[model samples]
Target: MADIFSPSRLGGTSQAVALASACLSILLVLYLMFFADLYRRPDATESQVAQTLEGRPPLDIHIEMMSLDPIRQTVEARLNFPERRADAAQAGGARVRLSDGGFVRELHLPADRAAGATSVEFGLDGSISAYPFDVYRTDALIAAFAGEGAQEAPLAVQLTVWERLPAWEARVVSRPARPGEVGLPISIEARRPPAHVVFALIVYAVMAVIAVCGLAIGVLAACGVRKIEAAFASSLAGMLFAAPMLRNAMPGAPPLGVAADAYVFLWVQVALMIGLVLFICAWARRGSPP
Candidate 1:
């Protein structure tokens, strides 16, 4: 067993193991980068106008909201008209109306426009309750007239709303119409990190630091750097105690034993415990405190 840690004996095997561990760590990080949409937030939707005039251009509308304020229950929104037209009136006008049990305040947008593709900016303030993971959704009645006939184009849209806090998981609900309808709704959702999600990410960051420390210790121990291994092992143990405190620091933290805790947090804790034990064993084998 001593030969495994000896610098002049079985050194090649130890080096190989260290190399393999490093490679595995790098591959894991790469996998996370490519496949993990961990912080993705869902927002935005789109739809096409069904009927068109004989010689009029097709009309497309894109709406987006951002800079959400949880306390005031408001969002900054933009309406974009991508298709340019020769007549400014051909682009038409829009109005935003809220559903029952909701209110809109401080809203401003141009009702008329000149020719060419254009965008209007506005703010929406609503009465929304964001507690116990409730979604505050309201509809904006958008009316526009297009072509020479001045047809009525109406859209019924819904968006998943959440508190503007960083890192929490918010639900996205979209209703797409079947064929033969005006057009299918195409949405582009904006991502916002909630508090819980941010906390989880922080915890994962600490776990990553622990993993780096573990890797360093493993490599050093393989090369018989006893003092360095002991130092890193002690640091690793100290970090283990600090990791759980992050949960307590989370703002508006969800109740314990949620899926994130059960799946991610618990697994991270278990891995840390195992790493601690291995460090202890390796330190003991070195026979004497550094």
Candidate 2:
């Protein structure tokens, strides 16, 4: 049995099996990479739009969320009405009213594609204390004017939040329409994609390794097991500065005091500082040869 488990005896077979397994894993990952998207399919977004527009109203304000600024708590969106462009022009162009509590705003969605899409910004109220795991929720009402009143329009009630979000994913849910509700009530929840969360974890792991290695070097020096050099000490000091740059490299990193800062950034910095101090103390005492 020991002979069967010997490294040299099993090397040929094990190398072939391991290589085949690695190749298969790489191919599978590549396949997924080709098709994976952080946003919903365009077909899916339009399908939902078609369903929501059915029998609702004559005018529709097709709202597509374009990008999100998590740090600023704002979402950028585009509004268009191609299907009702002709209708809107016949009825003095499509105009919509949006109400969020006491504040109300009017939006003019052009019917002509050449006229370009109307860009609007919505404020996000969700707290980002959780960072890469944060979710933002907001909603607005849609209503159109009719007859001679020149009423407001959020027409078409089609809200899509599945595009141009390379780092975030959002879900649009229908809010309970109040009896006196003047427009379409929509609620959106946006969260970081799995890639972001995975990246955050990887950052945490990398920070941990950096801190630990620094501590290991310091500890060895302080314990008199390893010689401390001036160049090595300077490198450790340089790392103290490099740590912040690494922390800021996170995708769409927020300002300081976020959970990620508390999780690994702070601790890593502290560890590195302590390690640098240890090395300095060791150098002072032993005075390793130049």
lDDT: which candidate is best?
2
**For every model shown, what is its TM-score relative to the native structure?**
0.37, 0.72
Model 1 lDDT, residue 290, Cα? 45
Candidate 2 wrongly placed segments (more than 4 Å): 1-47, 50-57, 83-94, 108-116, 150-162, 229-231
Q: What lDDT does each candidate get?
A: 0.46, 0.71
Model 2 over residues 68-165: C-alpha lDDT tens digits? Answer: 88877878878765554444664455667766553577765454442456777777777777987888877756666542464533345544444435
Candidate RMSDs in order: 10.7, 6.5
